[model samples]
Each structure stands twice: as structure tokens, then as C-alpha cells.
Target chain A: MADVAPNKLRLLKGAVQDNVDLVRGIRTPGLGRRKLLESPPPDPVQRKRIRRLWLWSPLSLVVIAYLLLPSPVVSLRQTAPIKTFEAEIKQTPATAEVKVPETEPQAPASEPHALDRGVIPLAIKKIVIDAGHGGKQPGAISESGVSEKEITLDIALRLRRLLGKTPFEVIMTRQGDQTISLDKRVAFANTNKADLFVSIHVNWTEPREIRPLETYFVGPSDDPVTIKLASMENQESGYSLSEYRRVLEKIYIDTRRDESRSLAKNIQAELYHSLKTINPELDDRGVKMAPFLVLVGTEMPAILVEVSTLSNEEEVQLLTNPDYREKIALALVRGIRSYASNHNGVDRKGS
Target chain B: MEETNETFCVGIDLGTSRSSISASNGERHVIDSYVGWPVDMVARKVIKKTVLVGREALDNRLMLDLRRPLERGLIKEGAKKDEDAVQEILRHLISLIGLKQKSKNRAKLRAVVGVPAEAFRNSKQRLRSALEGVADSVMLVSEPFAVAYGLEALLHALIIDIGAGTADFCVMQGRYPTEEDQRTLPNAGDSIDEQLLKLMREHHPEAQTSIHMIREWKEKWSFVGEPKKPVVVTVPVKGKATDFDITKEMGEACESILPPVCETMLDLLARVEPEYQENVRNNIILAGGTSLITGLSDAVQKALADLGGGRATVVKDPVFAGSDGGLALARDASSSDWEKLSL
Candidate 1:
């Protein structure tokens, strides 16, 4: 009994410590060892301060030393040419191995380098709109034989026209009904330096009355439904298995995930609220995370919006209406404009 | 040790199928973990209440938006109403044990709650937020660990907690269990009920049955081995009641969980030090509501034949084992430690 008392006391002490750790929000040991839970880099404002200090400290020291000296002196030497990111990209081959940028060390954000993606935020200027299904790959055909490709293209064009009147520059993955590989779409966005990427898609589900308006950002998902949708969207992606695995590995550390999620939430809320006032049957599926290939490969905030469900008979009829399509386009523009206003100080009216 | 009048301590087992609370004031109560809200104006008028809980909630489910509120021993995510339901269930349990939160003269409540072995940090944090309003101080521990502590099996014992939603296995090694020492499997009483319902439907296509009825039948006759008498149940078949002998179906459903349970048990046993493996196996304890199933201990003991041989014993009070253990911990913890656990 004496021995039992000590053992019980020790166990109780351990339990108490566990509870203390929980209250302090310290993660349980051995859990979340993955890079996804790795501490994110400092916020943009702090990083900017550090970068300014680093860039000016040595110059300030040199100037002070010169002023203190009785005699003026000058030193000059040949300096090596600094390598620009554009040079590196130009030198690398198209089939070169992909590597995750070393963003962990808080590398000095002194230059406007593309690889230093998350450290600084430039104003939102260029936007890319990707219509999900195109050409021979018709996504989610309705019972009445209306292809998802036709619907997405129509909505994408409408959105492009709506945004054209604003101050932002707009780029589309395809201007017409044309087959474009997922790899080319990602490459085009990166090459053109788009600030935000939006991929338009229509969903399909059983019990046709359930029209779910959902938006997704790239992250690991355990839900079987989300996994199935991701797998279906990833099909026919030109990337090899090894490349896909590499993309998945970086999904957690993608500094853009939070920004993408914020963008998704804005779009989802706007879509649901605007459509609900007009059509009360739509279900707000809420913003979720799924590893869609397009969302995973982008360098900027990216989202995949399932505008509406084609599986619903009523939604199918609504999609066929140009006025209803115009409403969806206007709602999407409002969401994008809101996200931009929050992120890059873009004007709400896109002035 | 410390002043007792100002503090009230209780241990709660917030389970998927049922919840139990054991208080220091010599009160113990158990209730089905069900919460519901009146679904319509007519339902509100008929039920004469804004919310219902436990047996009342289950009884008036047809007129209410009934919610189980828990999935696999954790609060189901993505539903705002489910969180409300969980809060109401906790409130109901506390009220049943004579701890009214609204009473100004009531003592400051300190609680120890038990959850599944592998519950994530996010789930634990969510539970803590949910419990903030119900108790002055709260502590969360794995359910199997609580059961082991309650049974005084702190040294060399393996506890298998077979609850409705999850089967938790923990190996006690004289110190607090770690992630490596615990495993949770989503195969237990609820899975047995589902399997039994599927089998009965396949065997008697015309018979009408519901999951609730199947659950009641399982609680009465669940066993993993051969039955002494034929198991039978009466159900409506084309508007007439008929007796369906479900002995084989019940046996199949009850035995279906054995493979996964045995596999996990052996796996955890393999993880223990070879020197203490025999002692741990010799002192195996089966706990939770599903542990009361007839012949389950014998079946588990038979599975231990591969590791030489072992004994498996069921707790005398399976339903209250977790909550009782929690209560014991609450009482034994020093006042300073309790202060550390305060919300």
C-alpha cells in the first residue's frame, strides 16, 4: 500500500503537468512534428523593419566613422555581380528538379525577388482566372447534356469583363474552348506574375436539391470526401508522381495558405449571401482545405471556387441563364475586390 | 488538507453514447449523452421546453432536432449547434448531480474529464473551452488511464476501455502513459450494433428494425461466443409482429470486433518491455460499458494464448469506472496542483 501511494502520486503529478501544458497551449510532445506546424516567419511589418535595419546599419556605421576621422579617406574595390532571380530562372532548364525555397531562416528581404514570396506584399495588380474544365475534358456533365466546360468558360468570361472596368489587369488561362494542361496553367500564372489565382468549377452531388457553394485552398485533408474531390481534380495532371509528392510536401509550409484561406472565406461568404438572397436553397458548405493541383502549385494566394452544383436540377437551370451567370460573376468580383482591399490596400471600388 | 466547504470536486466521463459524473458530495449519476432543441413552434408548444437532455431528449426526439453532439469521443467539428448541444448536455449532468451553476451559494466546481486515448490537442482545447462555463477548474485525461488509475493498476497492467464510439488501449508502467503507450480503435459497441443490424437485415429482409432498437437488443444479449439459448427478437413484418432468431447474426456481429481489438492489444503488448510484458498481460483489465458483454473477457483471454497465456478481468462497476477514477484523481490531487488546473 505504501508503494502504491507513491506510484499513484507520481501518476497524478504527470497528469497535472499534462493539463498545464494543454492550458498553456503547448503542443503535446511527439505530435505535429511536421513542417506544417513549424513556426511561421515574422509578420510583414516586422520583417520590413528588420530588412531596413540590415540594409542601412552598415552604411550608417561607415558614415559615422568617416565623420569622426580627422582626415578624409576613401576605399574602392571591384564588387562581384549580384545574381538576380530572373537570371536564375532563365538559366534553369524546364525539366530541372523542383526545390522548396529556404524560407525558414528569415532570409533578408532586401530585394524584390520572386523566391522571397511571402516576406513582402506588393499591391494587387494582376489577377488570373482559370476556368476549370476545357475542351475534350468536360467536367461534371448535367443530366440535360450541358458540359461543365461550357458553364465555367461562360462565367470566367463574364468575370473578366466585370473586372476589366476596374484598375486591375486580368489574365485568363484560356480565352476560348481549348484544352490546357494543369502544368501549363500553373506555369502561365507564375510566368505572368499574377497576384491572385481563382479557378472556377461547378460541383456534382446526390439528392439534387442540395446545392453546396464551397471554396478550397490547398492543404492536407483527412476527410474522405475532400480527398476524393482532390483526387478527381488531380487526374490527367502532367506532373509526375515524384513532382506531385514534392508539391504535397510543401503544402504545409506554403506561407500563402492563410492568405488563400482568407480569400476563400471572402468568396464563399459573398457567393452564399448574394445567391441566398436571390435563391434561398443554396447551402453554405463553408471554406475548406483540399489539395487541388492548381491551388497547390501557385506562388500567390489561390482558391478553387465551386460556384454552384450542376447536379441540382434547379441550379442547372440557373447556370443556363446569362443574367444568373452575370450575378455570380458580379458576386465573385466583389469577393476578390474585398480580399484585395484587405491584403494589398487595393481600393474597395478598384480605383 | 485544504478547506473543503468552498470547493466542490467532481469527475466526469463525457462519452459518445453516455455520460457519467461522480461527485465528492456522495453523488453519482449516469445519463445518455443526447441533447435536443424543439424543432418547430408546434414541437415547442407540445414539449413545453426550449431544450431537452438525456432520456427526455431521446424520448422527445421526434419533435426535436436531436443531436448526439459527439463523434468517436470528440465534439463533432463544423457545426455550431453541436457545440451548443454539448454545453447543454454538460449543464444537464451537472444539474443532475446537484451542482447548479446559477446558484450564488454553490461551491466553486473543479472537474476532471476523461477523453479517448489519442484525442488531438485541438480537440482537448475545444473541450476546455466548452467546459469553461461549467466548472471553475477543469482537467482532461485519457479515459483508459483514468480507468487504470481507478482500478489501482498503476504498475503492470493493460486496460482495454471498450466504449460505444472507441476502444482505447493503455499500458500502465508506473508513470503517466505517453502516446506510444496508448492506442484508440473505432471498433467497439457501436460497430457491433451496426454489424448486427446489417446481418439481421440480410437474414430477414421483411423484418423492420431501427438502429435504436438494435442498440437495445445488443445491450441485452451481446456476446462473442456461443449462446446458451437461441437469441430472438420480435419485429414488425408486413404490419404483423414476428419472432426472428438472431443467434448466428448476433454472434457474428459481436465477434467482428475481435480481430481489430486483439490485433491492437497484441501490438501494444509487444511495445512494452519484455521484462514487464508478462506482468502486464497477467493483470489485464477490461473496462467501460461494452466490457460488460458476456464472454468478452474469456474471448480476450483466449486471444492472449499467442503470448503464452494471460488473464483478463472486467471491472465490477464498468459504467462508472472512468468517472470514479476521475473523481479519485480529483480528490487526491493537492490543492496547489488543482490551482494549476484552474481555467
Candidate 2:
């Protein structure tokens, strides 16, 4: 102070005094309503500082609390539905919706989805690919530690990727390893106005080593083994047959069954042909009918494909290999592509 | 009787092979008592699951460390891992009936559990310990007493509770049954299964079968008297399933359990007071899972006919008898009878 000029010394003193005043105001006793009873009101600066520091205290505490929570809780908060909503996301405008009609109870029969025997002349605007046995239910296990769920998921995902180039709007029943009920899967297909439903499953049997690529449409079958397989699949539905038999019967009256069978045949054929290059002995178990709960109540043509048998040691080895898995995936894609290409030109009404 | 009110109370018959849960909330479920945890990280990834319960666990036993925690009608002691497995099982069971099926009213649960008659103190403690944070209040009851309480057969009824681990017997005389009125036979479902497996391995040496396969055969075709359609089942040989006749082995194995059960039935009948002995003999109740054998009751009755005139009646709902009885006990349990645990 002694070395400084007069104006500079005054400015320094004023700065010290202002900071002391700010500090005094920050720690000032009775800065609250109690102070109003005894002293003058806080000046504008003190009020502004108090507003900046203390007014948003509750919100600050909340933000801190949110940051401190567990990771799963944070993820759950982010992902859980705020409310039920229907959202449609399309990279390209879905132009084929005009060609396909949504099935109602009294709606006139449009061409059914010919997945197997022949193609129906119709545009498939939407498709649903169902990957079976997710979450708590891991469908089947193989000696090499491969699971049916993984095989189904991998194939479904690969098919989706392959079909991404097409104009079809592909919907997945599940995109991850999680459980979705059979009823829910059916509801999703029906509600989405899906033109076709393709359910993927890896087969299993008691004795093992039975490898085959089989496909199914919904109905009664003469084969006891087919009947047993239907029972096995329906057991997971957690519903009595009597509960859904009437509904299934009513749906059977419609033309969806024919389309489903056609679709199954096409897919089965493609699967056999596509995999012949890699494994010449791949068995084509042929398309058959069975009362699969997943196939029930879908307004569109639905088929459940037993892509391969997990019980078969040879199939298990093939399934574990990424290169072989891609071949299997390509086979499924070729089957669908064949049906799609054929269906585009065929006339509806069983032509 | 204390009313169960809207409070959700459950009765659990946690058997060695199967477990049944009957809740006051109108839910009755029976599941296999098989629990499996993935063996390794690869198994865990392949299974895409951590712990599998019931039939799901049984199906994926290859990639899992399958443990049927209850060996002889009681939780296996001495292993912390087994104890943990039992805890996981109880936890899964409680969640199955409580959270998933019934969404509303997730209040603290009260449970009444049935163990085989004359369970060791350590076994009871082990079971009780397993229920640590699962139930709010729990009481351990004998399998037969639970059935008696559920059936309202508190007096002059000889209850034979045959299960996977042990055949438990208890005679009721208008009060809580004691050790004197109860007898536990170790030769029950598992013993018969073991005998059947041994027989299959010895006789049909070419047939590829496991204890699991044998258990399936026993469950489907086991009989104590006349053969049921030859019990011809397909067993894999060199990865090919071939039809094998296991009728004689199954019949013999089923009968192996009969001598012990009949002997115990007679012994318990003799212990009843002279005036009530005849009534107890006439009102024999055959309960438990193994009691579902096609001709078990008839065999017991035939063996008893040699001693005196008696009847062996099979309970209609064998799976739920213990659980239903346990639920009834939970409803009628005095507040002091339960060991209350904080939820």
C-alpha cells in the first residue's frame, strides 16, 4: 500500500471491500424470511447470488441422485416404455401396401402366400421373421454346446441382413436373446398386417443324430411324429388345445393354409438346394402340416421352419461353423427369395 | 381358525424329484425339482441363461451343472453350494407363483412347507435357512401331517406319503402327529429308479440308457402287480433308438418299494390305540407322487389283507396333496407357530 499510487491503492481497497461484502452476504445470518422481521431486505446482488447458488438446490440434488444410481436401473429407465406406442420407421416409402390387403374376418380372399408349392401373384409389403425359444427358454442343446436359440437367432438376423436390400419391410419378433410368448408372436404378426410369417426353429428328438430340414403349416397331420412335434411345440404355449382349436378351425376355413403350405414348400426346396453345395447329403424332410401355436390366429400365411436338427451331431458341427451357418442362412434367404419372385407374377384366387 | 385374509400364503411340497406350490391366491403349480447353473462362461453364453429351473433346467443339463438338491426327501447338507442351490430353487419357486403369475399384491408372503416325516434337525434347519429372505413367515410340517391338515383328516387316518426320496408314513389321532406315529422309508421313487437303472444296465447291456431314461420308464409304466403293455420303450443303441422290453425290470422295481411301504403301513397301524386301529386301517390314505403307481394301493391292501381287513385309498390329487395341505396349514397356523422372518 505504501509503494502504490493513490488511485491504484483506492481501487485495490474497493476490490477487497467488495469481495468481503460478497462473502459477508453469503454467510449473512437471517438471510431468510426471519431476517425480514429484524432488518432491511437483501440488496439486488445478494439476492442474485442467493438465487444462483441456493434456488436450484433441490434440482441439483436430484441430478446428483440420478447420476449415483445403478447401471441396470439407468438402462431400464432409458429403455422402458413411457407408454404403449405404435411407430413405423421406413428407410424407403413402403410402396407395396396398396397391393396387399389386410385380412379381416369377412374380407374377400386375396392370393395366399405361396411359400412352397407355387408363387401367388401378390406383393408382400411386410414380413415377420420369428426366432423361437428366447430368454428363459433356450429351445435345445447340442453335444458341441450349441443351442437352438442361437442358431435360430443367427439365421434370422442373417436373413434380415440379406433381405435389407429388398423392398420388403422386415419385422423381427425378437432382435435379441429374450423371451417372447407364442401368443405375443402371433399377435405381433396379425397386428402388424404382415404379408407373411416365417418362424424359425432348430429341431430336437430323443435318440439324437436325426438331421433334417423340415417345414410346417398349421393343420392336422396323419404322421404321429408330426403330431408329437406339434404337441412338443404347443406345450410351451401354456394353453390347452381346446382353448384355441375353435379359433384355429375358423382360420383354416380361410385360404391362408394353402399359401402357408406353398410358402413352406418353396422354403424347404430352397433350403435343400442351397445347402447341397456345402453338404450333399442334406435331407429334405418335406413340408408338413402341424398345429403349431405360433402359426395359429395369424391373418396372414404363416409357416414354422425346422431349419436343422440340433440333435444331429453332423448338423451341430455345421451349425457351430460361421461359414456353414452363412450357407444355411443363404439357403433360407434363397427359399424366401424364390417365393417372393414367383409370387410377384402369379394371379390371386389359386391361379 | 385364523383367517388367511387377503394376505397371500403358500403351501410348498418341495420333494426331491418334484415340487408343488399351492397358493391361497388360487394358483396351483407342480414343477420338477431340478435346478441347473451353466457350467462355464462358454456354457453360459451358449445357453444365454444364468440359472435354469424345473423342466427347462432338466432339458439343458448337458451345458449346466445339474443338481437335484434334495437327495433323500431333504436338502443335502454339508455343501454350501448345495445350500445355495436350494436357496436358488426356493427363490425361483417363490417368484414363479408370486411375481410372474400374480402381478398384484406383492406383499410379504407367508408359507407352510412339508418335509418328509421325522426330518433331521439339521435338515429342517437347512430347509428353514433356504427360506431366509423368501418368505415372511414359515412353518415346517411333516409331509403326511400337511396332507392330513389339507384333507381335514386329523383323526383316525393312516397317511402314506410316498415321494421321490422317501416314503413317509404318519397316523393321525385328532392331534399333531409325533415321531411315534410316523415312519420314514428311504426306498421310494429314486430307489426304484436306481434299481430299474441297474436292472436295465445288467439285462439289456446293449441298450443305451441313463438314470434319467430309467426314471422316465418308471414314471410311465411302473406297476406293482400285472404288467402294463410290456413297458416296451425305445432306448438308443449306437445313436439308434431300438425297442427294449423293460416290463419285468419295471415291475420288480415297483414291487421293491412295496415291501417297505406295506411293512411301514402295518407297523404304523399297530401303533394306533386299539380302539382306533381298525378305523385307521380302514381309512388308509395313499398320497405323494410315487403313490400314483398303477397298482401300489392294491399291493398295500393285499399285503394288509393277510394281517386283517384294511383299505388303501389313493388320493385324487397326489401332486397337490402335500402342497394343498401345507396351504391349509398356512391358513390355520397360529401366529406363534411360524418362525417370522423380516422380508
Candidate 3:
């Protein structure tokens, strides 16, 4: 009887080992066939044992499934429907009366049309327009006697006029030619609760031929081409090319960069569309991202626009023309309008 | 002796070059020792602020009268008006460690501030006054003792604190430091920087050099003992290209500060009990920012070996060692009656 008990125990151990091996084979990739072929089939006694195991398996499965599955009672309590019902029952008479008005509109909404469904607006709201290089900062006088500051102010005023007609309110950081520090400009946008900000400026190059209408946003993006364009727009007047390049490369991994790229793309698309309609020969200077002090610490979507290259003689001539100035303003207005329309329900007016 | 924890204490390494504060709440932070005030109404118009502290003030020094209050290991009376700025900086630092908030009632602050080893009583009084409003009580201790406390070497130990402003030494005899056990010398990291500046001026007369540029060079390449490579640095001077030969120049500048350091160490060692002198020598621990320079430990060890009596060792983490010691003291003594615990 003792010998028979030891044999039975050996058989049980063998069965458990085989089950472990089966599980291991399932877990390992490309080893199932080899494991199955190497193992012998069950003997007569083992076969009988296996038959007995099959008989008990359903009962064991019931126990295991109960242990493994989440409790139905706990799940019922956690369900939103149950929670909402409980919340309704717990509400005071005053609170319940307040909630009654919310459900009154539902009486006529049994079968709601798809068009009646409200759209979720974009998160953006107020926009602060900073016209760079105003007052004492004339900022790059062109050969044609056009000041960059004057051109920026003209475009900014036009942008405000266009944005005013839209649902989004417009706030000009500087409404007239005024000297505002970079820090103050960013602070003004932040303090006034401006949702999106734009700073307008005209660019210049040492060589006369380099002319491009560029728009800038802060930080870099996944798109390398856009990053390079942004770098070109951010270059300081006297800084060597290598120094500027190094600065761009250093800030490439900055994570808050996607916001900048999105703003740049929106502004570039609108500017290019409007400018191309007026002057096909005007350089399609693409959107770029760079570190600009005026754009820093602005808790909203911010951009800086380089309207035209003041260094180029032909571009300078166009900048001085009153009609061209109005066209530039119109293009900025179109950009602001597009941005505002996409992001509805936000107050864009200056605080 | 084991006792109940009742005294919540903090240790502050209030250095002339870089100041750090550590509390029992497991925080140790460092800030540059600088104070800034607006030059005039015109300057405020440009900067938009009346005062700036630490690195920001140093960076925009063109617009502010930057005063480094602690000069050569003591508070210069001329710069004493900066006490308000210093207090503000300390207040900011304390708030960073989660103690200054009204909500935290875990402990009352009893601080032991480590000043220069040989600081005058007047300077110590000034330090105490600076800490008066910020802490419940403040105690002034020698900087080297604070370093030794952090190391847990209470008996027969020597500490060399090579700070930017001064090299300080203290001999521990299982008690708080006395005047006899402490010594200080003024030629430290900042002194080395001054010497290097003078050298650069003599070598390259046309260079538009500032102390900032010299300090940058020192941080990058300042070394003593032996040269691994030629230290040739290309510095922009007046928007023109210039390469300065700094191999020998840097070596001389760094070495000039060593004589005073060694002398202070020897002076402190002589003051220790003769029977425990050997033990103190073996337990010599080098600490502070200047000790972070490459090969500084080796140089100190070699210098001491030349004296032929004992060995010297450097602390592995000088940056946080003093603060951690103060924290440990705070935790251990926190249960003692607040009135009984000395600040």
C-alpha cells in the first residue's frame, strides 16, 4: 500500500512538471513544436488520472474564475449610472430644484439631429499684438526711407481691425508707436490674460539680395526644415552665422516647442495666401521658430511676424507704399480671423 | 548618550563664495552669495525692478550696483547695507526647504550657521542678526567644525575647508570648536581668480577681460600639481581673436593659493592635544567647492606627505556633507526641550 502511494505521488509530480513545461513552451516563441514532439504521451494510469482531472476541471475553473474576475457588487457600485442615481438622491431640495432646469431642454431632444450637436471649440482666446521697434527703436531704416517700426504699427492696427469683427476680441500690446521693453511686453500679454500673442517686425540683411517675409515662433519642432527657417528669422544683427546655428541646435530638444510650430504654421499659411494674391513675386519666406524675449513667458500661443526684408531695396519700396501697407494689414487680419474662428467661445479682447 | 528627540535644528554653511542651508526636513540647497540694488531711478527704468539677487543680478550687473556682502570671509561694513537683500535671499532659500510655510508645525528652527573659522565676533554678530528673523534661534560655529560634524568624526579630527573666499581649518576635540582649535587664511579660489586675471592682463594687454571670463576659464581648466595637456584657451578680446597660453599661467595661479591653505592646516594641527595629534592627522578631511578641483586631494595628500608626519583625506560629497550633519543633529536632538537646545 505504501509502495502504491509513493508511485501515485510520483505520477502527480510528473503531471505537475509536464504542465509547467507546457506553459513554458507556450510562453517561449518558436519552441512549441519541438517541446511537444520530445515529450511522451500519457500511459494507461496517467490517462485515467487525466480523465479524473477533466471531471474536476469545471469545478476548479468556476472557483478560479470567481477569484480572477472583478466582483460584480464592487463594479456595480463604481459604475457611473449607479453613482449618478446616488448623487441625485443625496441632493438637497434647493440643489435638486436647480438641476431641474438643466433637464427641461431634454424634453424636446428625444431625437436630436447631428447638426444640432455643438462643436468643441479650439482652446485659444485673447490675442496681444506687439508691434516691435516703436518710438525710440526705429529698427532698421531702409534705403527707401521706410522705418520698420512704422510698417509694424500699420500692420498691427489693421490686424486689430480685422480681428474686432470676429467673435474673438483683439488687444493690441501697443496701440500706437511706443517704446515697450521686451519684459514688459510679455508681462502685459500675461497680465491682460491674452490667449494668443503676435509681435510684428521687419527684417534686414547685410547683403541686399536676401529678402524673405518670415514669421517666428519660440522653440523648435519635430520638423527640421521649419526649425532651420525659424533659426534664420531669429538671428541677431551682428551675431555670426555659426553662433546663431549653435543657439538653434542647443534649444532643439525643448518640449514646449510644438505649440510654437502650430502658431507659426497657422500664421504662415494665412500670410502666404494673402500676400501671394497681391504680389506673386513676393518671397514665400516660410514660417520658423526661434527664441524671442518678447514671446517668452507668454502663457498663450505666441508668434512674431517679419513682414518684409527691409534690407532689400525692392521690398523696402513696397513697404513704404500705402496700398502695400494695407495689404500687409489685411493679411495679418486674415490670420487672426482664421485662428479665432477655429478657437470659438474664447474672449480675445484685452483685459 | 541617547536622549529624547525634541530639538529641531538646521545647519547652514553660510559661505562667502557660495552659501548653502540644510534642514532636518531632508533638504540642502546652494545659492550664489550676491546682492543687487538698482543703481538709480534711470537704472530701475531700464531693469523694471529695484533689486535682484544671486545669479540674475550678477548676469545683469551692468544695470545694478552688485555687492558681494561677504568679502574675504567677513562682512565688510561698507557693504553691510545689503543686509536686507541678504535676508531676502535667505528667506527665499528657507521657503524652498518647506519650512517657512505656516502649515508646517513639525519643529521649531534652531540653526547652527557655519562661518569662517577665524571670523571676528562683530562679523559673527552680523551673521546672527541676519538669521534672527528667519530662525527661532541662531548659533555661529566654525565652518570646519560643521564639515567635521557632517563626517561624524567627533574626536581627534582635522578639517580643511577650501572655499572660494578663504581656506579654513579646525581641530575637533569631541566638543564644539574653540578659538585655539580654528585657523583661517584668505588666499582661496577667488584669490586664484584675481591672480589669473592679473596674469592675463600682463600677458595679453589688449584683451577686454572681465572677472567673469577669468572665473569661467578657472572652472574649465584650473589645475595644480602636473599638467595632463597644454591648456591653450582661445578667448575673444574686443571682438578680435586671441589665444592665451594658460598651461603655466593657470598652474601658477592655482598654486599661489596653496601656501596659505597649508599654513592654516599646520596651525590647526599644532593646537590639537599632542597625544591625539596623530589621530587628527589621520582623520584630516578636505571639503568645500575648491576641494572639487581635479587632483586637489592628491595635491593635498602629497603636500602633507612632504611634512612626513600624517595622512590627509578628502570628503566624497563636500557639497551636502555639512548640511546632512546638521540635519542628523536636528533629528537626534529634536526631542530635547526646545529651551535646553542651543541654537
Q: In terms of lDDT, which candidate is strongest?
A: 1
Number of the top candidate by DockQ? Answer: 1
Q: Model 2, residue B275: displacement in angstroms?
A: 1.9
Instruction: Give the CA lDDT, 0 to 100, for residue B262 in model 3.
Output: 72
Segments of candidate 1 deviating more than 4 angstroms: A1-4, A28-351, B1-3
**Over the stretch A152-246, how does candidate 3's per-residue lDDT look in tens digits?**
86677656655665666677666544544454566678888877788888887556776677776653232344433333432222222332233
B85: Cα error in model 1, Å? 1.1
What lDDT score is found at residue A317 in candidate 2?
62
Candidate 2 backbone collisions, by pair: A115-A262, A115-A263, A116-A262, A116-A263, A116-A265, A116-A266, A121-A346
List the candidates' TM-scores in order. Answer: 0.58, 0.48, 0.46
Assess the local accuracy of residue B175 in candidate 1 as a C-alpha lDDT between 0 and 100: 81
Please identify which of the two predictions, 2 or 3, would achieve the higher lDDT against the true structure: 2
Candidates' DockQ values?
0.20, 0.01, 0.01
Model 1: CAPRI class: incorrect
Local accuracy of candidate 2 as per-residue lDDT tens digits, B265-328: 8866775789888898889998999999998888888988876788889999999999998887
Model 3 chain A weakest lDDT span, ten residues long: A25-34
Isolated chain B TM-score per model = 0.98, 0.95, 0.87
Candidates arranged by lDDT, highest first: 1, 2, 3
